[model samples]
Target: MNSWIKLSVCFGLCFSIAGCSSLSGMFGKDADYRKNEAELAKKLEMPPNFVLRRSGDPLVSMNVSTAQMLEEIDTIPSFRAEGIRIESNLVERWLVIEDLSVKDVWRGIEQFLASQGFKVEERRLDIGLLTTEYLARKEIAPVEQELTMISRLLNSWRDEMVDGIYDRYTVRVEEQASEVRVYFSHHMMTARATDTTTAWRLRPYQPMMESLALYRSMLYFGAQQDHALQQINTQRVYQEVKEADELVGLRLAATLNESWDYLLTMQYRANWQVERQQPEQHLLWVKIPQAATADQGFFSRLFGSIRTPGLVGIKLTPVSGSTAITELTLVVEEGNLNPKQRQQILTDLGLLTE
Candidate 1:
């Protein structure tokens, strides 16, 4: 009876120490410390026979089970991947929402734009393209009911009352392996004072305005919480590469049809305005704009100093792969692009992957 009591006390003490160590291991400052504690807990299964007064065979089995439970806790996702994340680069930004389908994002975008007072002028779900009608400057924001004379005068100087200023937004959606990439393009229009009618011409793109629009969209997506967002273990199967000759292209794990649809939808995004697409020849003639200037907060001119609208060809070819797996290669037509210019163009196209 005494021996049993001593064993009970020993096991009780062991459990108390193990529980505290396991809790501390979860939030220790150093990773090594947690690892060592886990190892020590596993070793506790076989408490010394001298200390236990008898062989601790039962205690050994219990320790193994406790060690496994602790290890399972470590497999949980990191805090960042647990929820939606708003990420951005120089040219574009995207949200990482786990387990969200392309269709879900498409619907969310339409609802978001409408909520922001943008009338959906056109929508094509089959191709996943959405364009908003030009929203006048006045309708873009709520009107201030009361304005002092000094404030009104300041508004005049701030171009707040400029006539015929309006903005248009376009959203592009592309499906990645497990997530979606959303791209937003902003177009502006100004009414010519000389015209008798209301005619609006395309205005230059503003980086700040574009970023603001995307940020708002991300907020809306997070608030909806319609789909479950969690971390997914995915591989980098889609990649873009540049050849020794300075030609740029993509090596995707998707088939020709999948790649075609993705590229076609992406044309509406950013400044890659599509002129024509020829699926037969697997070629597309696109009008890519020159880089923005210092006034726009980006470098000037992409391919050359003389910036003019011209057609650039994009072609896709099937590499080698099985029916279930497809390997497609993307390449530029390389019409008049010099070696240096080709390298620059490749770098710009690489941003498409992001």
Candidate 2:
């Protein structure tokens, strides 16, 4: 019996070692396989004039810059099993999922919001937009560690009262080629004490909250927890370009033609209604929606005070003596927009000039 037990223990130890070795070998091969695939994908390049079309959309010519074109091509083969990753610039961050269709991604988003107790207030699948109703959550102020008796009593009483902050999120999902991009915009309202009564005032964009939302959505889409967290923490940095306080104009490191293509793509992604365009002069006139500009809460919109949309002219001109640079300028055509409103529009268009 003792000889039999010793032989069994020796066999178990050998099997465990073999299993570990096999797993290590498999992981190493996977890493190398991915590396080789990426190299091969980079070797494959698309022609400058290659036309691409979105599902159910007209074929769009590829007039983008060489760098942008190559960047897009390189990302085609790097999709993991979950097919999700983060893409960001200096102004904003968005998720790019390659493995899922628009409908599947939309369904996943709905499920995620429902799990978080948020109701969809507005949905336009044709335009790939979803707006959530204002979700009010209590904000508990932190109590002092070494509080006096009076302070402790006050803290206890305040804890019993309800003080809340409200957040409304707008998610835009755009399908381009083989990838579906998801953009998240946050609007917040906080309680402000006035002389007569408390009012809810609009707060600035909460980027961390937006990041948290993206992280959760990635998890919902079957991304591994560690991978999702790593992707969320890895933010891309871009060079800063200075502009006016109101973001009237900005410069791009591309030719006039490239700039035109870039802005046209931006208009589509932002859902900007293009009233007219002059490709000969590289000019476009677009209308900005009221809901985007006003940033009103649910109650404010319920009162039926929505404003008319604003029209703006976008003009692109080449920098003097430089074929590789272009300057973009915005001119308000129709409604009176404040600096804040103009900035908001620019941000929505992903043009953070300031």
Candidate 3:
């Protein structure tokens, strides 16, 4: 196992050279992250016990940008993988969600997030991530209001493998009242047996549910609970909300595609479609190009290109899904209703959502 990891990492390092191999004139061709790990660690205050517990193949990516990936590359076990640069804009746009309690996972996330200096926060939602970005901006409506849109968006994602969000609802101490309450209402969607994981991802088979029909008797007339607005500038509050909501798409990206491909490959089934009303102000659900996609040969091809430490791609429609996810529901939780702001968010994420 140790030998195999060493080998994989070595090969990965070699491949990483595609971005920038010999910076001869730039730095005399001898400078490298590895030789400087100790000095870098002192400057970065990076802890050494990071990769101690891992005993298997250290994950890696395709051609990556060394300068772009250096911060993360430094802390990642130094187990030997070639460095490559990730798109800065993509680096600038990253998110991750995890169960959050796991120490190893949290530690890794913390270290990586710090190295990247992303504007990160912890919430009740099940996500953990490290990003080398500073591009996201958020706006909000209400926690309950946010949930409504998220539920609706999930429903639409099933129909279209595409995912997006033009607006957001988030609850943080600064964003929401110190006392927060969330209400969830699910919209039922049928999942064709695409794969075990797809079935699981669609409806949380990990936590089975009974189709219990429930209802609310009254309309949500804005603030149901009373609290002073603490000198809150609605405009500033609105801007923060928009920035926070922007993360939902990036966080959910990996799960969208991963879930779809894994499910379909298990069977010979896969298909979906998405339509966006506008590019800047809308979510465009794109079809994963059929000809451009390919089948994985072994564990290498299956997981090889998956080494992006930032936004692991979304696991979307499972093989169980007889079609691709095409119905992109752009839930604008809050916006100027001004077309430009909406368009920028969609365009940046490159979702077929609008």
Candidate 4:
């Protein structure tokens, strides 16, 4: 048989469209699919609405400016923009799947989008780290040669048969890698339901019963939202960023971790870098915007995220050794970003250009 033909034949035997959407219906012995899912879920300690999976990490190196990317972005067609259609009135919004895993889906989406007149600017991946830990343990039963001893001893108090107990396995996938390196690690949590029910009376009894219960638990807890992720056709990507310039000020402000010293006395010499090579056009770049007013710790938005709370403006930062992929910043208005706000930014850059 041809190599590809042989591979296809093998998959034909193994893959089947079965109870993928129903957690409660997926249980049967030799049904290793649901069993594996149960074990994986339990091993991760994933709660209802939590998740466990793997994919690429964001590549962080540059601060993208909206003005520079906007002209190019305007050409990109909107996609999968929330398949919502109300009364034939085309909804005016982008369909988004805001998950970190969107990176894995964008590879083909960008192409599909280009075929439809859309522009996609792929962000470089920033390597990060992953960590793991163990959450539980169980006892092992030894086999016995004596028939009477084997049936009456350890098997007498067997929870699976009498109390309908199941040992669950959960797994957690986490990432902690830095900008240059990426790490993947997992932790597990396993335990049995404290109560029992009279269920599953059949040949494939113990394993099948436990499997169903575990699967049910996984669904009861594993739902997550990917709001910042965008998808088109079958491909997914980070939503186009509308602002990174205004982000610098927001970030710088967060670093202070406090309301800008409300009444503190501080001063900043204003410097606007203006450049207009063609005299016909004008370019005025202010490194900082006004301080962020919305409390983000309460909102939890990504840096440079357009889904970000709101934008007044933006700034740029070079990837220097001192530059962190993430920064907390606050840039006040000429005399308003809090008295101490301007001082902090100027001090950090050592740009006291009198």
Q: Name the candidate that leads on TM-score.
A: 2
TM-score of structure candidate 4: 0.14
User: Once model 4 is optimally superposed onto the true structure by TM-score, how far is the C-alpha of residue 231 displaced, in angstroms?
Assistant: 14
Off by over 4 Å in 4: 1-106, 119-226, 229-354
For all predicted structures, in order, the TM-scores are 0.36, 0.44, 0.17, 0.14
The local distance difference test score of model 1 is 0.58
- Give the better candidate number (2 or 3) by TM-score: 2
Model 4 C-alpha lDDT per residue in residues 1-354, reported as the tens digit of each score: 699999998787655544443443455445456777887877764432225322332221135444655654554443332222111001111222223243432332334334423343333334211121222223444445576865767676754422222222221222223111111111222232436743331111122222232222222222112322111111211111214333223222111212121101111212222221211211112333222213212122223222322211123222234332213233322323432333334332222111
Model 2 bad stretches (over 4 Å): 1-81, 149-162, 193-196, 238-354
Q: Over 4 Å off in model 1, which ranges?
A: 1-133, 136-165, 169-199, 202-215, 220-238, 243-247, 264-280, 286-300, 305-310, 322-354
Order of models, best TM-score first: 2, 1, 3, 4
Q: How does candidate 2 fare on TM-score?
A: 0.44
Q: After superposition, how far is residue 83 of candidate 1 from its true place, in Å?
A: 6.6
In model 1, the Cα lDDT at residue 217 comes to 64
What TM-score quantifies how close candidate 3 is to the native fold?
0.17
How much is the lDDT of residue 74 in candidate 3?
54
